[model samples]
Target: MTIADLAGTPAPEAASATARVRTPRLRRYAMTAPTFFAVEYAINPWMDTSTPVDAALAVRQWDALRSTYRTLGHTVEMVEPVAGLPDMVYAANGGLVVDGVAVVARFAYPQRAGEAVAYADWMSSRGFTPHATQYVNEGQGDLLVVGPTILAGYGFRTDLRAHAEIAELTGRRVVSLELVDPRFYHLDTALAVLDDSTVAYYPPAFSDDARAQLRRLFPDAVEVSSADAYVLGLNVVSDGKHVLLPANAVGFAEQIGELGFEPIGIDLSELFKGGGSVKCCTLEVYS
Candidate 1:
């Protein structure tokens, strides 16, 4: 059965629901410009203090991703980037917006803690009632929306306890998954939700139990190779039809193409130094 078929999944926000059909979705997303993007601290495995980050290159790559989204007929909104907050460019970690409810992020590390307050204010400005979580949650980096189901990952950046808080905030069924690999610190690092009905992931990133749950839920799921996962390939943004991904993840591009989705590759190798790509740079604004 599909994730949509799961019991207790939240119903559409509107009382009069339209039929679920395949059409080009005009997606709305929130992004922060990499005006102050940098790698001053190491929170994840991909970050290194000694490595020189080309902020100019990062901005160029980010602008290209934004342009690609607009070209595909998607709305891209900018959140003002704060100086001294280099990681602000990874906007997906700002919050999780579902059915007009914005569950703001509670970052695990002190380095990123200030970002929560910044995103909370931004979310309120965009017409969402911000709901704060007591448990540590890093927004879409760990919490992914699958139709009405929320796939949450923990054992690294996010605390597992936050999954229940997420359910209360969004009124959706939260499927808690464990991230076992240090390299795949966040769920988006190892998994991609292709559409409402399907997902692709790296098996070794998850725990045995989490892997079992995934296998049972998405039998047709694409299993990605280490070659692609290492390059943060699964960190992609999809509007059901087209997927925007890092240009280096050729293997993942081919796999998603087999699933009949157009994979649009954009180079954000500079941003990868900060530990994110297309999906990490974009946060879906559900209404």
Candidate 2:
């Protein structure tokens, strides 16, 4: 069925909803060094601490991702990694940055709660107007920016109440999308915003209503396959023209390239063992 049919909107209405809207390209990002790597505990469905993780390999993979960003002419800033906080390496969970202001995350899990302090300090030091969130929000892990709206995910790591707080804090429109699959707990895991007007997402990760809303809004979105989604392929980072995704996601990479985007695949397998890849490692710091 067509997206218009699914959303119960006229075809013309759906067409207008996805009309091109250009926003400034993102060039700066915040990342945390994976100095301490170990899956001591499982916080998300993707984490299996019972199996051992290669700390040395994880560091090399992370460094490669950072190097990839640098090669693309993007600025990469670092946040100091604490000794015991292993999850801090996924810097996107630290907060959401938009329009030069950062809405720092108040982590839902105690394991990650302390990370808010370091993220806030870095954002403040970087000249961003930092606003600490009152409700539980996992930074950009559950928050994504599309053209003129912020697509937020709930029913997982982030609380729905934070949507209002984030909208008020960033002065942007927030649309809440409920996540259904535990594997795709964070919105970033299931959706990759390629540009202000384009996105790639896994339909099975979202609730029926959320899927319908996505259909209504992004009629031209690429629907990801289960194979790619299984490897955290949808967890990608894009800079308008280039999309950096997991090397294992060959099909998704080809699809992205066919859409006129340069898909740069980087091996983040070791980090994937910790339930994060490209997008999770890099947090956009809007200029």
Best by TM-score: 1
lDDT of 1 by residue, 107-183 (tens): 99898888998899998898777898888999999999998899999999889989999998788999999999999
User: Which ten contiguous residues of candidate 2 have the minimum total lDDT?
Assistant: 6-15
Task: Estimate candidate 1's alpha-carbon lDDT, on a 0 to 1 scale.
Answer: 0.86
Which residue pairs collide, candidate 1? none
For residue 173, give model 2's deviation from the true position in Å. 0.6
Return the top candidate by lDDT.
Answer: 1
Per-prediction TM-score: 0.92, 0.90
C-alpha RMSD of each candidate structure in angstroms: 8.6, 8.3
User: Stretches of candidate 1 above 4 Å error?
Assistant: 1-22
Instruction: Report the C-alpha displacement of residue 90, candidate 1, in angstroms.
Output: 0.4
